[model samples]
Target chain A: MSKLDQFESVFKAASKERFHYSPQELHSILVVTDLPEHEAKLYTDRIRDYLPLDGENITWATLTGEEFDDIGGLFEGIEKYRPDLICTYRNLKSQGWQWPYSLGEYLDVLTQATTTPVLVYPHPEKKEALEKLGQLKNVMAVTDHLAGDDRLVNFAISVTPKDGTLYLSHIEDKRTFDRYIEVIGKIPALDTDVAKTTITQQLLKEPRDYIQSCRDVLAQHESSPKIEEVVQMGTHLDEYKRLIEEHQINLLVLNTKDADQLAMHGLAYPLAVELKDIPMLML
Target chain B: MSWFTWFASSPTSVPASLAASQPHAHHAVSLGVTLFFLVLLILMILSLALEEKLHAKKSVIVGVFAVVSLLLADIFGLLPLSQAGRFFVENPLHEKIEMPVYIPAIDWGVVAIILGSSVFVDVTSRSGLFSWIAIKLTKASNGDPKKLLTYYGVMTVLFSAVLNNVTAMIIVGSLTVVSLEKLERREKLLGFLLIEGLLTNIGGLLTLISSVPNIIVGNAAKISFAKFFIVACPYVAVATALTIWMGAKLFKIEGLTNEKEMAAANEKVQSFDENDGIESNGFFWFATTMTGLFVGTLATASFLPYIKDLGMGYVALGFALIMLIRYKSEADKFYQAVDWDLLAFFAGLFVVIHVMEHAQVLALIGKGLSVIVKLGPTLGSGLVLISASAFSSVTDNIPLAAMLAKILGNMNTPSSSGLWWSVIFGANLGGNLTPIGSASTLVAVTIIHKHGLKLSFGEFVVKALPFALLQIALATVYVLLFLR
Candidate 1:
């Protein structure tokens, strides 16, 4: 099946699922970009057209790199406008401008700093793949933490078309978990195995509860798409790829914890590059 | 009961019998007690000078020193336990009469004013009145650096002239940081802060109650509130403008040449909620009313003999008390906000100066100044201005002001407005010469440091010296031209 065809079919099937969500309709969107001021405006204008949102109800704003650099100032903008969604391009690069961090790093930081769902296109060149195909079908929302993914899940559900399949995926990379357990054990007199077992049990227990919570939220909307939960224990990169291929995930959603840490070693950067074709909505 | 007035009314010319009957040092006090107090005072000054390095609270150091010095004075019979301030009061309604009143070395009037002004300023700041004014200015200036500086500079001067310079510095400093942060001009704020710091002192010079030194010298010289305003306002106006211009050049303020940058700054400013910091409308309005009334009372202090004699301290405290009563439940918070440490520092500093007066140390300084007084008002005032600036640059102006006021009071010269004005300029402008020179400079340095701009003493002095010199020069011109 063609990507668009598969997306529409999956969404239609998902709509039949026993879920409900009284999803809030977005009123405004802010597009933050490193593009030249005029280019940024034009780009956001194009996005507004693609979203097909009525210009009167749904206000669109274009913030350039310079404006984005002033975080305090940007927060004031967020507070005043209360934009429902923030859109931007990932891996942005520009000359004669000193970005506080790399393009991906800034994206990670911005997403983490704000509560508004950030829909980041992999690159401006990939605009067609993200916007043209139009219908959002196989949408996957990924989270390492179980509880905090509610916002991300709700966001994914909101964006997915009625004929789309929304997958809730969690990967418990054993090696990373073990390393964390080892660090905890280094705290004098901690029982490493017992602590590890307690943490593992605690960790493994949350995703199920989180999925149920998400399912309940989705249950609110009458014509929402199919909601599916997937859990895997292995290396994150390989597991994520396997899930994506198996489900034919068109768009990925993830939660960013800390902007600083995300900037230094964000999974988003590597994952975006590896899954270069997939658009991401980071919260 | 008015210690300030009692001391202020000390006889300008000593009678022959009083001078002849003045006891010898050995007869009045022992050498050991004098040496001990001097050594203690020197150490206190040293500790204050090296306050940052010592990492000790200056108030604690000086408070201990004052206690020790007072105890030694008592032990050595140097304390004037029974001394009474005797002066002839010229009552306009009645015949002049000799009046005697008790006077403490540490004048309670100065203490009351400092503490009261501090609390009043804190409450006003908490009410978001200053922030509201700041946001309005930022909006009006549209984030143009030069325009913002002018508005902010004028406001700083106005605030400092009425409120304490330290309090004014804080209000302006916080405003500067918030505005610059919005403008993404954090790198430029330090120079702006330094300039504002200098301007606070210039503002302080505009009124007798503006700074501690002004209060000291103004009281001693019996310079009325209206008289000080009339004399110093023009000098303050000129100095303020010159300081702002010099600041723009020195800081290399990046002018608003880029339309794009200016627009971004304006856009950011537009996002600021003017009501964000305001606690409540009622509180804000009430605080505003009280502030206006307080300033009104101060401006009319000269015209109202009752108010002038009631003292600036009484009025400040009365207003502060009224506010506390109105906000009874939040009274503890207001009290907490008062700078107790600062009050304590002045208390200790006052006692130390008193010790110097009792020990005849002040008399020696007076004799030195007597030589300058002989040069006539123009040159004498010029010399006093230069000396005051030099002395206050290295030490806390509070003690220096106290010491200078006493020395000038003892001189043969009577009612030298030029000399008193020189002291005012010297003490206020001199504060800009060093970070430790005045409480206001320290406050500016501290706020800048809080915002990650660390300025060393040498660096602060380097930035401040040129401005101090210019102000001193202007003050000289004013004194020689008008005051003389």
Candidate 2:
């Protein structure tokens, strides 16, 4: 109500949330799979070829099917190795992958209960799993809110080959956006058109700004992979599936943990379940 | 007169003249029966208070009490033998007259107002109007902690006045979380939320329909909607400002000390889009216009012809109907969203209170209250205000307000009496004393816990005691100086 208050309000209206990028270090990789020792070693070698963790001192460990039985055993194996990164396929020790409704109990609990970043490759039984992992040429990092996710973006960048392209994509869930907008529409004080446009712009703006910052930072490096931005508002699963197919993306990266709940991130579970033939890096 | 002689006289409807002539006249029920019913009433209140701990719904607790009261009233020959089940009593003339029963005991007017208002507010909330205003206010604070505290506090009051306290708290409390989180000032969240929660009770005193206690007390005193608002607005304004100031001082919520910090704070809030919540332009405009009309109609109901006789409840219901017509095909959805549990609780509560009246329990309470009144209007009113506030701080204020209003009414207290204002102020402001005192404050505590903040009950009481005491003291002075 005062002039000072008025000044502060106007100043706040002109300000925005800024994004900062931080690089991620991948020092150790642990590959877990439900295969015999020889076959597990073979799979680990194939993963080593695709992931661009080239540091000479970087450590690698393999946990075969015979090494662990249940969730507890898998956790014990992971505790023993304590790697910065865990690479595995969906439906780890279960036959649920044969039916396509869930990410299997092992992947579900592993994604949510642990702090270590997980790289979920397609179930090895899928016909296209090996073909999709042949080259990490197109690595796409997807999330509902992409701003300020420096670790996810950095991880995506680290995995992509220098000659490959990296896509930073953010899709605002249309259902959620509409639900909130519908609430606004019922309010008598707001102008509906203004709310719709401004909110849509603001939602898209954060991720775009963050992606631009990514571009700005990567521009300084001569050998950095090419960075591309894909931002849209749509139903997440359908839009993501379409984007992955359209880009012919080799590796998908997304966040799997929810800060508020013990369950896997709402979007990640479905994306992990439905995209059975593509390699995914779940953070 | 003999029982046959009294019963042979035509049973006529109780006249208003009888109330004026024998204001404190009560049935000659046995002291044992009266004490028994009194204990039952206390048990009901205790059960209602421990609703959460017992894990039983409030409606169920009150509903069981209502039925038990009726059965006991019937067993003790307190209930009339007439098929109508009216409360029959002999007047000074020894002529039998019938007092209205069960259905009339539940003030449909109060129930109507709550139901209608709930429907109307719920429907309008879907339009994102509250969210938009909240976002705009957040931006207006420029993300300054002190400024944010002030804006959110005032907004909480205004929302509580128009909407229910719980809705007001949720809308503002949630925005506080998001806004503070964005500014990277989560450390101030507990303070902001706690302050906003306390302010809701202060705001609830603004209008006649703002809270259940206000509605119960205001209706009993026959305070017109406009008069209720005019009388309480000044006190609410002062209390709100004082509470906000106290919260800011106690919580150390301060403005940016340096230019660079201020600029950064300003920048962070700019990202908040006020219009982000709106979806439909037509519905938004319609809801806004209707809300204005609804408030105007309620405030002017007594002055308007035809509506004056129908009372404010019809005005609320009429407006609710108009709004419901917008989504006629899906009207059931809004209806389903209504707080039926609250309505059922009120219904059962009123029935129990009605039986208490028949059993002469109210007259007993009135006898005690009369001693306080004899202390002289100023001192008496002040004592009443403080006492009601203290009682309300620890229990459900609705039943307290209802019982006190009935006692005052039995004592033939005038409509303009300061006693009515005392009850109003005490019933509304008392909730600030503890988290469990009111639904709104409890919600605030829940939000705090949900955000991973630790706020113990003793800690909340210690923090809130000063604000509650100051507000009650202010109300006492206001009643003595003006309303008395």
Candidate 3:
């Protein structure tokens, strides 16, 4: 991805993190220090991907509280709202390590001040949110590196478990198997059934087929993930709602690579339209 | 420390579990891991090749030593411990390759000892520790060479107890020269004197933090800072004294006074900022306040597992800031003089070390050393010093110190020794193994460079080798005699 695209992804992911909480709590109750309001919103939005908000009493603090006095204002703010969890985006600066606050005083302020839980979130703390998103377990590469019809095998491995029947789909094209194989070395084995489909073909993509394909791949290696494939109706927002209703997919994994929706139109639209309660693990 | 240990998990119990049960086991080594190890190895070769004064053979040995580290990491999967999460990356196979584990329980304290002594030279020299001593002796002698360096070794021993050897040498050496210059017209032995001072600094660190590796070990072991200082003081004292005696024998000074020239050069300049003068406010107060802050933090850290919560940094920083604010203009000069780049270097080191910690390759090496030592302070200390001294030849010593300090927090070390001592020993002594090892050596060189003089690598080693050996021996004797 381009550098700008990478930044866009990070921002998109960050925003999903905070989208679930009440905007007022985010805007007024929490004062983020160095993260700024913009970054805080981004973080929330990113988290919204994996952890869909049930609209509970969750308070997200974006500031790095390095000093005892720095927390005093927030302490009182927290007391009034009495939020369930107070999480700070902690890095080197937020520890409040200025002198008079002796480590003792700093500890006292954090633990003694409130009954609410204080959780410090280091950068990239939510590492495993979507590690298990793909059914094959091993996160496969998106590179169309193969030449001529061999991509079907690649798709099989990509979509099926190392020990199961392969289920494959593309947004635009519908072929029995993908073209190209020379670039990918030799294919693993040709026993599993590999087919082509898309998010539009919801009724055809059965969960049993996905599980069987995954099992085929797993015979080669004992530790492969159980694969499941569900078709979303379209790449765009309106289609995702229809797809979610029809497919009833367990999780939605979107790569920022193909989508062309500028700004939030691409993400926020689909996120808003899709079933908000189902866990969507976006990288 | 307690919170972090709890967060880190037991070394023996690998964090990774069957893919079906535990979701958190994906934390393992990535591309970043391979890259850091490569950089460290490349630098080790470069620094040794570039400078002849350092032990070249040892550098090669260390380069091999670094390579051995990989076997102990995640991909190799030699260590049975598996607390780390799995790592995923694309390989040639259609399926994504799923192999990412950090080395189990990497310890950086070994590196602490490697560069400890060398860095001490720079710190002590810059701290004005040696300058103060040199000036006192210089004034007392009226330029008599014999009387000037009579107790050079003794002074080194005593000073090493407080500061590392490098600082002691610079403080003592510089003043000695100043005094010598007082009684003479033409100065010829400035080069020899500075070299000797540099050597003395290396030799004096009998204490753990006084050297790089010792600090690494002490910190890895989770020993207290104060207790380390108290225990290692005598060893430092003896090593320092031995350094001085050896120094005097290596470079003897003899000259007659030029009465007319001496009087003219000795003329004093009047000061404009009267308040800024040393006599204006007692050094005792500054020393006491700094000491109090240092002692307070250490005492608190020893007792409180959640010390970070207590604003320890803020408290110490508060005092420092207050003093800075109160004496703003005055302190600014010193602030300007302070080695800020070194601090930046230190900050970068923490990030690098943190990356290593997350990778876990370092901890694998630590486990190996743990087996050799069987939980004794000596072998643990030996490993810390050797590693620190070896690696520090390439990297900055402070970050090396900090990394070791953090790792020592997670190792199987003796609590009685206090973590700080290992930090002191490895950092201070290990620094001595190279010319870039300590601050005093740098200061001494810069001072010489300022006046248009330079010492070749071979020259430095010749002057420093025996003295360095002597200091380490003296320190070993002291530790054996008292610390144990």
Candidate 4:
């Protein structure tokens, strides 16, 4: 079964909220993609792990570096998928692509026959970290694509007119498989804030162990920003607006997921549309 | 006889002197009331004078004077003690008199606008330049007298509406004579334009701001800027049409000159079309903005009582300050054109009327008129119009218009619409009757004198008075018929 077959209800729920944001028809198939393939395959079963199972048509595709060498073929491949969405990881080399210029060729190909809604969900780690910080916990900043581990750059930033010191706690929440199952129960009632804080508090229940994970991640840091642990919730768009305004966040990072599965399901897919004004990058 | 008087109460021929000696309190009450009213009146005057810079100065002076005066009078017991005060309080004597009632403050808007517009027109209507042009245009026609008179009448009517009619008449009067110098028929053109001023107050009627009393009515009624124009534009059009129609009959000239003379004059007028002294009315935008601001402030004043929203008296200061800043060079020139004497005249007249109001003389007059009308507004409106017309011929329209405006106030009645309309009609049209009737009439008479064209009071009455009377009658009829 395709990844799109796993989660069709997430897209339908979003579509119900606003017809303008929804696909043109109720039966529109969402085509999903996970790109810049890594050595370890992302759990393809994760698509089916959540979201409702009915009233959707979706397909999933995974792409690698050489496949993108021919731009025309890549664009043709996008249309051939007949996607309601095209979720893919960003290339680490350049800044995120701007609309029209960024998605124009693929969109142009879609317009030739099929015009689909493309959604991308970066890993939700940064959003979860920002939400955790708002809940009166340790603060963290996403390093720029160019910023190496010299942490003095953002130290001068202050919320008020006067300057103040900014310290990073490198707080990490490491969840075991058994705990994540229990977390799904709390997830039903908790909002983005509740969901995020609960996860942080759970990891910090044994504060020494959580700090050790943070130390290891920081110690092994490359020039590229490490992905923060992602927390999923029922509503992503509202959570996104509040986080951006409150935190003055300017960029969102995502992981490539099957776009067809996303257009048919989770906030991970719609994250691209919600954060359109800001830069979104896929890890 | 004394013993018998004590027993028999002096046989009742009259009450005993002791019986009458029990004092009546009416005098004491009247005395105290009159004095109390005097103090309040004084305080109000002081308040107004200090309102431009309203502060503790007026309050301190008024407070001290009030406390001291009351204390001093109390010490003397002239403040009406006991039965004396009670006597007058129980049975008051009412004094009444006949006075015209009208809508208030709107007259000042008229005066401000007329004066402002007049200053503008005066600066625009070039006497020397218009004269030069007129002469040149008339020369080719060998200076035909009738064509010159025709041009003079047209310009006079046009300017009269814009400026005070008399000033327009004068400016046009001078140029007409200049234009007719070659034809040697300057008197006839001068006379025609002079007469035209007597008839048409078209400009005055066109807008609430154009005339003194219309503004007074507009403000008193709290009419909106947009609504005033809507209501008044038709009346003005009808009035102008009626005046023109009647004026044509009155000014019907006999025995027209041939085309040869007309052609020569047309060529002469064409010849003097130079641009000297005819600036492009450069302040049109400023004038328009100020006019809108003025109208807006007045319309919104009822909703907002802050000094800024009240009227031009407060708002004009700001406009003046801006003018001083932007056009500092022309400040003096503009000041010269202001007619501050007219402003002073208005102020002095305000004080005089205030004095009368303090005396309750005007109130007495109002009460007497209320008796005949039974205070019913429709009849009151007619009586007021007749009286305003009569008085306006004696004094300048400003004071009379103001006095009538205050008396009428904001009377609430079904007929008040007519009454309001009547006040404007009476005050504006009444200004047309005699040389003393309006600032404009005097202005025209003065300029006619300058042109070597003599128009005596008696002569003007014989020639122009009938047409002027007809115009006022038409206005009165308009008020009674349509306004109601």
TM-score for each predicted model, relative to the true structure = 0.62, 0.67, 0.42, 0.43
Instruction: Sort by lDDT, best first.
Output: 2, 1, 4, 3
User: Per-residue lDDT of A48-148 in model 1, one digit per residue for the tens?
Assistant: 65443455777777777566555566666567767898877666544312332345555645676777777776455566555653445788887665454
lDDT of 4 at B339: 58
TM match of model 4 to true structure: 0.43
What's candidate 2's DockQ score?
Answer: 0.08
Could you give the candidate ranking by TM-score, starting with the highest?
Answer: 2, 1, 4, 3
Give per-residue CA lDDT, model 4, range B18-90, as digits (tens).
Answer: 3223222122334444455456545544453443356433334434443554444445443323322221111
lDDT of 3 by residue, A1-283 (tens): 1212322222222111000111112222232233445765665555443232224554444443332235566565556655544433323234332222222232234433454333222233334423422232222211111111222233334332334432222232223123322322245553222312322232232322333333454456554444433332234444545554454343343321223532322342245223333332222
DockQ of each: 0.03, 0.08, 0.00, 0.00
| Candidate 2 per-residue C-alpha lDDT over B331-407 given as tens digits, one digit per residue, 9 for 90 to 100 | 99888888888899999999999789878888788888899999999999999999998888888899999999888
Q: TM-scores of the first chain across all predictions?
A: 0.65, 0.91, 0.26, 0.29
Task: Report the error of model 2 at residue A135, Å.
Answer: 22
Chain A TM-score, structure 3: 0.26
Question: Which stretches of model 1 miss by more than 4 angstroms?
Answer: A1-283, B1-43, B82-103, B412-416
Which numbered prediction scores highest in lDDT against the true structure? Answer: 2
Better of 1 and 4 by DockQ: 1
Which consecutive 10 residues in model 4 chain A have the weakest lDDT in total?
A14-23
* Greater-lDDT candidate between 1 and 2: 2
